[model samples]
Target: MVNHNTQLLSESETTISYANRGLNYGDAVFETLRVSAGKVLFWEDHYFRLMASMRIMRMEIPMTYTPEFLEAEILKTVEAEGQKNKTYRIKLLVWREEGGKYTPTAKDVSFCITTEILENPFYTISGDFYEVELFKDHYVTAGLLSTLKSNNRIINVLGSIYAQENDYANCLLLNDKRQVVEALNGNIFLVNGYKIKTPPLSDGCLNGILRKQIIKILGQVPDYILEEASVSPFELQKADEIFITNTIVGIQPISKYRKKEYGNTVAKELLQKLNVKARLG
Candidate 1:
C-alpha cells in the first residue's frame, strides 16, 4: 500500500476546495524527484526550479515556505511512509488556491508532498532497450511556459497513450514547427558519430533536471561534442544512437526506433558515470 501525506502551507488539510484553480484551470506546477537513502537528490536544483515555475505562474508563495522548511516536510512524509532508507518517487505539487471564471480568487499557493515507495532499491539501467516512435497528432507550442513542468500536459498524455496503443515503450513529441522536441516521459538525445544532438529549450522542451546534468557531464568529456540544435524526425532516424534522460530513469538507450537498431555503448558509459556521480555526491 502507498501512504499519502499532504500539507498546505502550515496546515495538514486533506481536502482542497472544489473550485481550486489547479483543478479547474490547471494553474499549478510540480516536480518529480528521486529520493534515495534518505536523501532527495539535487534538492536545491529541484527547489529552485519549483520556485521559478511558481514565479512564471505569478503565484504568491507563502513567506514561511523556505527551502529548508519544505525539505523537512518532504522528509517527514518519507519517514512516515517508512521509506527513509529506501528509494522512492517523490512529487511536490504547488497549485493556486480556489478561484472562478478563468481567474484565481487568491494568488496564494497550496502545495502537497506525496511519496511512493519504489520496488527497486536503486535506479537500475534497463537491460532491455526502449522501443520508441514519433508522435505527431498534436504539437507542443513554443512560448514562455513551454519549459516549465506545469499541470498543462495534454500533449504529453496523448503521446503516452499513443505509445501504449501502438506497442511502443515511448514516443517522441514534436513542436509547433514540427521539430523533434522530446519524448513522452523524458528528453531525447541523438548520437551522430562523435557528436550528440538534443533539441534546445527554444524547441519547446521541458528544461528537465536530468537533461541539464547530462549536458554538464558531456561538457567535461573531450572526445564527444554535445550540440543543442533543432532536430527533425528524419535526422533523428538517421542518427547512430538514441537515448533518453529523466529524474527517475537516469538514462536509457533506445534499441529500436522503427527498423533502425541502435547500440547502447554511449548510454552504458554515461550511466556508469552518472551512477558514480550519484554515489560520490
Candidate 2:
C-alpha cells in the first residue's frame, strides 16, 4: 500500500494555488535512500547526489537538510518509525508543491521512510530464464535533462511498461545512437571473461550510486576491465555475463537476453563481492 500523506490528509489543508510547478508541470527532484540497521546506508552519498540534482535544477533543499538539522531529523524519523535494526526504504522528494503558473513560485518538500523487505540482489528471484531485447542506438538521443532527476519519467515509465508487457524481466533502453545505455531502472554492466564494461556517462545515463560502487570495486582489480564504450546488441551477446546495478535492485544478473542465456560464474562471483562491499562499506 502506497501510504502517501496526501491520500490520508486530503481534506485537511488544500494548498491549492492557481498553478504550482509540481502540479502544473513536473518540475521537481527526488531521491530514494536505503535504510539499514536504523541508519541509511550511503546516506551521505545520497544527500550529495540529491544536492547535486537540486543544483542542476536550480532548486534549493529545505532548511531541514542544513548541516545542523539534517542528521537529527533523520534520526528522529527513523526512531519514530521503530525501524531500528531493520532495513527499510527512504524516499525524499522536494518539489514545487505550491502551484503557480508554469514556473515555480514556491515549493514544498516531503520525506517518507518506510519498511519493506527488499530481496538481496545476490539472490536472484525464482523465475525462468528471462529474455532481453537488444536496444538499438539510443545514445544519440538528446539528453537535455540528463543531469537533473526530474519527475518527468516518460522514457523510464514507457520502457518498464514495455518490459512487463513483453514478458522480459527488464527492458534495455538505448539512446538514439543505438548504444546500450541502461535498463529501464538499473545501470547495465557486462562481464566478459575478466573484463567488465558499462556505458560511459556520456552515453546518457544517471550516475547511480550503486553503479559508482561497482565501478570503484572493479577499479581495484588489475584483471577487471571497465569500458565506457558504445556497446551494441552483438557485443552484449558476446559478453560472458551481464549484470545491472541500482539502488533498489542492487546488482542483478541477466539469465537470458533474447534467446541467449548468459549464465556466467564471473557475474555471480561479482555479485557476491558486491554484497560484502555493500554490507561492510
Candidate RMSDs in order: 2.7, 3.9
C-alpha positional error of residue 66 in candidate 2 after TM-score superposition, expressed in Å? 3.2
Which candidate number has the best TM-score?
Answer: 1
Name the regions of candidate 2 deviating beyond 4 angstroms. 1-20, 97-99, 107-128, 134-144
**Model 2, TM vs. native:** 0.82
lDDT of 2 by residue, 1-281 (tens): 12233232222433444554654577767776676665566667777887787777767567656633554455555555554565656666666556456665655555433335454423343345656775332332436466345677677777667777778788787777677778777788888777788887777777688888888878876877888777776787788788787776666778887656787576556666767776775
Top lDDT prediction, candidate number: 1
Q: What is the model-wide C-alpha lDDT for candidate 2?
A: 0.65
Mind giving the per-residue lDDT tens digits that candidate 1 earns over 1-281? 22223432332435567877777788889999988888888788899999888888888878877899888878877787654788878888888877556766776777787777777655567887579988999998866688999989998899889988989999999899999899888898899888999999998999999898889889988879999999988887798889999998888898898889888888888888777776665
Error of 2 at 100 (Å): 3.2
Worst 10 residues of 2 by lDDT: 1-10
lDDT of each: 0.83, 0.65
Clashing pairs in 1: none
